[model samples]
Target: MTVTIGFVGAGGIAEWQHFDIVEARDDVEVAGICDVNQAAASEAAERFDATAYTDHEKLYDGEDLDAVFVCIPPFAHGPAEIAAAERGIDLFVEKPLALSVDRAREIHQAIDAADVLAGVGYDWRYSRGVERAQELLDGRTVATIEGRWWGGVPGDDGHWWREFEKSGGQIVEQATHVYDTVRLLAGDVEAVSGAGSHRLVDAVDFADSTSVTMEHESGAISHVSTTCAAEDHDAHLEVVADGATLRITEEEITGTVDGEDIEESFDVNPYAVEVDAFVEAVAAGDPSPIRSTYDDAFDTFALTMAANEALDADGRVQPAAIDDGTDAGEADQ
Candidate 1:
């Protein structure tokens, strides 16, 4: 089946993840491209041989697309998702689904009410090593999960990513992958406390470096840190589940346990496997493991937001739940 696809943003993600997977797949087709800038849309449309539009509504309304990928910045997400879900279009929205918890829940309701297949692009959840680690760590008592994502901050390159309202600082903009992956390995975060600073980057007003401690309802302790200060970019996710430790460093994983030395060294390319999974889910009507379901993504996003809140005030933020009402507790069973 040919799955028609529309996109709300045609910047980095479109050039990278969306184009690579959607265009490569025999079952997927690029139906329309939308961007606030006509030039960008046109360039992407020509490159992909798809139609482009300056306004998202035209792309959304004119085409009978199967799914829409909302790769717009965080601030643009709420409006984009509202339109897609209302149209009953299956959606593949990128991570940090929204800048705030309230907007996240609103999108959740719209998608659920529309009875659409909705998923968020928490891309790291699709990594091969990440999947292996989750299997090893599942049904085990996880002790600690530590992660660090450091790189030079993205400057204003005519993108909304430079704006705080759009990106929510580096924490929400970039570190959300680490945040979401930690939750996937550990569990739902309960309490958050920490500190952050704007000592490095001149682009954003808020902190470009943040460190936080989270206590999960599973009693697993996690240490999360992110910064745009390092000279070279790096990513790492390490989980200590009981006596076993599974780690993936800035570029790869090393070490072994139980005769399985699961290691995969790789370049940090922008393309992702999660996009394929989302598209496949749209085709098959079956949900993927890391669907970034409304509740799951919001919990991680709220935890990240609350971590920032606690850091700014030097206090503990508790009951990290969803509902756009600041009711930070676990989701309903």
Candidate 2:
């Protein structure tokens, strides 16, 4: 049976990463498209030969979709996700689930009660470089993990991403891929301490450079720093384990493994892999193969939110403090 999918947002990521991939699939039909920008939605619908709607409620009510991809900005997350869950339609949501923890938890509760298949857009996990890195780190004790995202801010000065209230800053908006990868390789973050400052970019209200230190539940240590004011640098992760070091980029993984120099390159498109996995999972009614589920991505979001809170407090804070779960206490040690 062919699965009919609708897109709730027709932004860049939705158009390039998601719609393009799903459009290439033979067993899936692009049923509808929706965006706040009617022109954009109409354009996408024209390309796919699907109906267009300016509001998501109209799209949901008009299209009998098996799944919907919610690719809106961080601040515009809750409604589409909740609506899809309520309608028993599976969902593939973009990263940084919501701008605030409370709203994310509310959406989580709704999704949990509905029990529909759900996936998040942490496509980096499906990269062959990450796969190889995971394989190499399996039996080794990871000592220190360091990751960084150094680049210019996305979009123009008027973009929503530049506003902290709209995008949740660079940490939650852009650096989330690195944070999620760190959590995947290391483990759940127990506590985070960090500092941020608006050094260069005057266009955005948020910080231009931010540094965060995380303590994982498995006793691994990680430091992730991001800057939107610099020239493009390879945003990647380097893991130092017992007698081995692994450096992972989006396209390649290189380093020493057991005193032997090893390098591997990835030609696979992770976005395609991620989309295929979600489609297959929905077809089989089992979401087991999806790397980043809504709940798992929420943990990453909570960690980023905690880092932002720590920056505000000028001290360390536990991830639990932001999520209203068990108290992991302050990171004052």
Best by TM-score: 2
lDDT of 1 by residue, 62-142 (tens): 999889988887887787888888988888887778877778888888988898888877767766656667667667788
Q: What TM-score does each of the candidates earn?
A: 0.91, 0.96
Residues 1-333 of candidate 2: C-alpha lDDT, one tens digit per residue: 798999999987998788889889999999999999999999999999999999888898999999999999998989999988999899999988998788888888888989998999998899998999999999888888999988887888689998988999989998999999999999888888888899799988998999999989899999999999997765999999997899998789999999999988979999999999999998888999899998888888888888888776655788854346543346674
The all-Cα superposition gives candidate 1 an RMSD in Å to the true structure of 3.3
Q: State each candidate's clash count.
A: 3, 0
lDDT of 1 at 137: 68
Residue 173's lDDT within candidate 1 is: 79
Note the Cα lDDT for every prediction shown.
0.78, 0.89
